[model samples]
Target: MKDMITHIYKGLECFLLECSAALVRRRALGGWRSDPRQLREQRRDEFRARKVAE
Candidate 1:
């Protein structure tokens, strides 16, 4: 019984850690998407690429 509980606890802990990591990654990416400077830089890169392709 003790081993079973320990196994379950370890599984839950791993699951929670994975979820936390995913949330952190999502927030980081979300910040980049919402950042004005990042958006502007992306747009500038796109424009430059288009100009070069022409």
Candidate 2:
């Protein structure tokens, strides 16, 4: 039971880290955007590229 809990916690931590990284990338790209649509597209492209690279 203890080991299962530890594994679950670790998975959650990794998920949170990924979310934070995506948010950071979104914010950074957002700073350069003047249009909401462009920002959304930019984030989507960035996320795709990162996933492909990974």
Q: State which candidate has the highest lDDT.
A: 2
Give the whole-model CA lDDT for all candidates, comma-separated.
Answer: 0.66, 0.72
How many clashes (backbone N, Cα, C below 3 Å) per candidate? 0, 0
Tell me the spans in candidate 1 whose CA falls farther than 4 Å from its real position.
31-54
lDDT of 2 at 16: 84
Report the CA-based lDDT of candidate 2 relative to the real structure: 0.72
Report the C-alpha lDDT of model 1 over 1-54, residue by residue, as the tens digit: 999999899778766865565456557768445666765575567556755975
Q: Let me know the TM-score candidate 2 reaches against the reference structure.
A: 0.53
